[model samples]
Target: MSLPFNVQRAQDRMGIEDPMADDPGLFHLSRTERLMAFGACFVIGLALSIIGSALVFTGHLAVFAVCYSLGNVVSLLGMCFLVGFKKHLKMAMAPVRLTAFIVYIAFLALTFVSAFAFDIAALCIVFAICQYCALAWYSASYIPYGRKIIKSTCGTFAKSI
Candidate 1:
């Protein structure tokens, strides 16, 4: 007895609700907010890649290779986290941030090797200062939590666990 168009209209009306009905949380950034956050990350990555490429163009092959490799490793880790965690920022921070920091330090130290091997001390120093600053900012923003756990007791011993 009901027209198909009327039934469709009823279904559509039933689906409407307040977009902000849910409380906002770390994982609940609106689409525009998410886009802006992602854009900032992308711009930083692009700038770092460009600096690495500039090293290549200026004949610092060893430095360029080290920078390039570090970038690739970090990017790959991020991609893996995004895929496995479905973009859950907190999940990515818990383990991957520490892993990425360790990897970054290892590769950053390798840049010193390139500096010594190629005798590009000044250039490497400048690059290191910039890279460290950028990384500190990145870490602060993305991994706000530090390694902290409540105290725990095991059979006969107690410690901060």
Candidate 2:
């Protein structure tokens, strides 16, 4: 099956030679199969996150933190289906994305440390919010002019305020 124009273009830009390329002695899947895996991982991650949020009111902060952090990690791993894991890491650490990636990763780890190690619910929540914001910034880096648009909008709002 042929890839959509946008997907094809993205693959070209990412330097992917073949969507069907397989790791030796490992699972071999077509683009459609990879997409299905990605979808499944995404849904599972979303469900975990929702479940974690619900658990917050149940007084299980630790569980909530574990579930929420795992959800984020799983969702991130889903991208490996589109680009190989190494390629994904390489792109994530590219100069344009490096700072956002570092901040996002730091917050992700801090969220867990605050919940489990420090046992501070408030700190965990704060770190989680920071993690979310970092993830958003990292994601925005992917779209053309997305960060610029966000900055301009925020600046306009600030000026209005």
Candidate 3:
């Protein structure tokens, strides 16, 4: 079997000699640039974590402080992991994000149910706040990095960010 003409024509027009050709663009990320971006992300995570922890000691701030603190801690750890295990962390990001979204929705359901059934309004509210903080931390950590990495790795699809 052979590839159809449209595919061949498209390839020819794009000047792609081989389907598996390595675009020089993919290799454009200098080691120094990677290091700088990663270091900035780590600093941001640490700063956010410190703020969250401070809030936790601020006279019973419902569950928001606790949630924020916990989320910030985990996010900082995740950032560290990403810096050290770049390939593995990148591979896991998509699945981890998807799973978090689904779980976030499920937690919303549970929060409502618990509020109604157990009258734990404060607790429920805190849980939701915690979830939001975690989401924010995770998003802050990866979304920027994801964009940069994807841009660098997009081969011919690469365009200005």
Candidate 4:
């Protein structure tokens, strides 16, 4: 069976345009939108770290904590690189961010379930779901704005950094 929702419907419901309407690779966003996206990601990272710390302090779920840390490291590095190329990455940013979001959420869910009390874990899962979706959407929207810059730099900017 097909899903009940599609990207277009979601955008329409949220009062946003088809972020790729003009040049499939150019999504323009406001400053507030960009800040909100980054903030949401930061919150998710903080929450995961807190949960990881809890697991470490209790001397339990060591395996889960290890996995969480590994995933966080990969995601953080990707984000850092993406941010450095944000003015140039263009169409590719959408898929890169989407992949990071999915992998991080999966690791987050597994970590939360294995590390915390049922009640607290459920709350964290719910909050993470909402925040991640917002982060993914905004990240996707902002990515297109970097197309021109990335194309010109050809990654030399990232190399220098």
Window of ten residues with lowest summed lDDT in model 4: 18-27
Per residue, candidate 3 scores C-alpha lDDT tens digits across 1-161 of 23469987998898755312222123344345444545676676566656654654554344434344444445444433333444434533666565654455456455555545655656666665656654553454356476445445665465544
For model 4 the TM-score comes to 0.29
lDDT of 4 by residue, 16-119 (tens): 64422332122343334444544665666666656755665455555435434543544443443323334334433466565545555565565456445443
Compared with the true structure, all predictions reach lDDT values of 0.51, 0.81, 0.50, 0.48
**Candidates ranked by lDDT, best first?**
2, 1, 3, 4
The TM-scores, one per candidate, come to 0.33, 0.79, 0.32, 0.29
Alpha-carbon RMSD, candidate 4: 14.6
The sequence of per-residue lDDT tens digits that candidate 1 reaches over residues 38-139 is: 555555555666677688768776656566546643543433222233443443356646564554565466556656676575566565555554455335
Backbone clash pairs for candidate 4 read 88-149, 88-150
On TM-score, who's better, 1 or 2?
A: 2
Top candidate, metric lDDT: 2
Clashing pairs in 3: none
Error of 2 at 27 (Å): 4.0
Residue pairs clashing, model 1? none
What is candidate 3's CA lDDT for residue 144? Answer: 46
Can you give the lDDT of residue 149 in candidate 1? Answer: 17
lDDT of 3: 0.50
